[model samples]
Target: MRIFLFSILLLLAGCSQTLHINERYSASGQNSRVQYIVLHYTSADLNRSLQLLTETEVSSHYLIGDRTPTIYRLVDENRRAWHAGDSQWQGRTWLNGTTIGIELVNQGFYDTPTGRYWQPFAPAQIEALIGLLKDIMQRHQLPPGSILAHSDIAPQRKVDPGPLFPWKQLADAGLVPWPDADAVARQQALFSASLPTVQWFQAQLMRQGYAVPLHGELDQATRNVLAAFQMKYRPARYDGEPDAQTA
Candidate 1:
């Protein structure tokens, strides 16, 4: 009986071993594991949104509901969430490893006889989102311009958090960057005089952190990416064709 008890104790100890490590120093040359925040709109109500994000194969770090504008932390920030599937940003692919995703409950868009109609976000929802964004940015020590729309990172397939998302409000809140009207007007004048070549547009888009092709052709994929940028910066029109304004 003594020997059996000793063996059981040994097994228990093996199962519950702990490790101790030194914490005398910190590194100054390293940056944060999280580099970007991707925003999305869940095309469902609160209950369906909860079901999709929590009980399915998809998930995000946070979800903002529209009815009460409640913020839900579906997943912890210390762990990876499956929100950004097959996503890329600024030359970094597979953004799920390095991005925090926030989904807002919305109906997204629908088509009518005239054209497509997008659902506008409520003031309360936007307010709640701004508060949540500030908290996340502060806690993660993220810099300005670290937020991106789902289409911005995955333009080829996704377009949630669409054009009516009030990006200017975010810029005003210092959460993202806004273009200088003077600089854009100057460039627009130059482009008006002589528009840039397709290759030039491709190069510029690549520099803007999109994964565009450099083949100098106005292909569909390139146009899709351009449309993504246009929707964010110039919501008046975004037909995916290069224009003086787009330039």
Candidate 2:
């Protein structure tokens, strides 16, 4: 009887040790570390997108397919994804640490005799993305403003989720805020008389969450940022020129 009891005690102790190693106590009122949702275009079809995002160094948390569309979660939300390379937003830099990336299977753009023409995302794909966005936002308690475009964060080197992206649809779904048309029209008129100086444009761009140089010069860097902004807000024309409409 004594030897049997000793074996039982040893088994219980081992079980307790395993439990201690596997389980942890936690406090309440804590949330996920996810702070932002960055959208991108895969620039490839379903098979190619899966191949690149899954097997390559670049990856996103989710990928929305095109035809026969569905949202494929490539990376777990708790883990950091390799998207958003050399990126920034507001005052934060290196956004991959804090953002969840969602890539849509898209052709991105094709050059034409007129200009570069960007392809539009499929309606079904966008719908799937909206549902995924809602789930992520609800779980993370993120606001509409936290949803961003890849181009918005990395203006100089990246332009995925380009002009044809349906930002207005997200805005309509209350997932993102859109610039007031009335206000833009008023500002456009005001600036038309005399376009703001390059310094003012830089300041406004910075205020609007773009990381542009404040050197008061329309250099290549400044043009790149302006083009990025126009790609999001004024997609009809993003010539990188500081005109009244873009101002």
Candidate 3:
């Protein structure tokens, strides 16, 4: 009986060493793991999109269909998705670990005489997306600025949810930020006479959450990042030129 009691005490002592018991509770500061919601275009049809997002390596938290107004919840919000690959945003890198990616089923774009023509998202599809965004943001306590484009995070390699996307509509709905027309106009006028230097443009791009190279030269990488920004804001034309409108 004494041996049994001694063995039990030894086991209890070993367990205590590995366990921590704290009963104090405070409801003060709190935050969620989710920080950003990145949007993308599947660039494939609905069936193909479902296949790629499911059977293949690529995945997303949600996918809005092109034809049907169905919002497929491919991955749970609490889990990570393999959507944003090698991405960075506002000094944060490898966004796949920290962001919720939503893929929209659209054909992306094709070049034409007028310009690069990107397929417009269906109204119902966008409505569904807005609803999903509202729910996710509300649950995660995410701000409007957290809503971002996949292109915005991976400028060097991506430009999906492309220029034809109705960013203003989302902005109006308070889902994301949009530049004030008056402010943009004033800046355009100021920069029209002489566009800002490459360094200045790079600085502004960084301020807008793009990871641009501050080489003071308009290199290809810088141009790609600028084009991604223009594609989101001033989609009318994005020749990667640092012009008044682009600024």
Candidate 4:
């Protein structure tokens, strides 16, 4: 009788432990409102990136390797990952709540003449990124312009997934808008003779979903927003100044 009681107690304890483990693994408490997919470059090699993302608290939903176009899923899509730190978009802060971060392996930026550094993104990696992005966008019902870079949300401090990223290629696939060349050309003509009012340009940028101050002054905040915009829409020249074409 004593042995039987002991065995029953052990069985109940084991069952309780199993139930707790199963509850922990279940998705009862996970976030479900994933809306945006943010892209980033690891600025490190594949192995290092994998190790850091897996071991460290910082993580992303997916990591795309440089050599091959394959994507490694690090975090589940339904759960929130620890990425997009100190970010803001369209007046919303802390983008991690609504975004899925995808980190690609790359060296990021390199110095060049004119004291400007350029970053190189591999063509194959970008191609792979497009497919992954398409699937995520479809799953989340993300809009055409919903796809964003790490730098786009954190322009004040971060610059990863830098200027070399192929926004045009993504736009070609109907992922984002390709600024109307004709509209830009017309704006360029108007801007050449005289710079448009700072307020006018700011309004256009705001209309395009950039967070610009409405003060009508081309200040640092405005410049940062313009630089981010130019990097995405007009990659050829991201001088940050409201030049003829940018204006």
Provide backbone clash counts, one per model: 0, 0, 0, 0
Q: Whole-model lDDT for model 3 versus the true structure?
A: 0.90
CA RMSD of all predictions:
2.2, 4.8, 4.2, 5.2
Q: What local lDDT does model 3 show for residue 139?
A: 92
lDDT of 3 by residue, 156-223 (tens): 89988888888888999999888899999998898898888999999999998899999899899999
Please give the TM-score that candidate 3 achieves against the real structure. Answer: 0.87
- Report the lDDT of model 3 for residue 75: 95
Model 1 agreement with the true structure over 70-106: per-residue lDDT tens digits: 8999998878999888877789999998999999999
Give model 4's clash tally. 0
What is the C-alpha lDDT profile of model 4 across 104-190, one tens digit per residue?
A: 999787667767666577899999999998998887777788888786888767766777888899999989777789998997897
Instruction: Give me the overall lDDT of model 2.
Output: 0.90
* Number of the top-ranking candidate, with lDDT as the measure: 1
Report the poorest 10 consecutive residues by lDDT, candidate 1. 82-91
Better of 3 and 4 by TM-score: 3
Off by over 4 Å in 2: 1-16, 19-29
* TM-score: model 4 vs. ground truth: 0.82
**Which runs of model 4 end up more than 4 angstroms from their true locations?**
1-32, 112-117
User: Which order, best to worst by TM-score?
Assistant: 1, 2, 3, 4
lDDT for model 1, please: 0.92
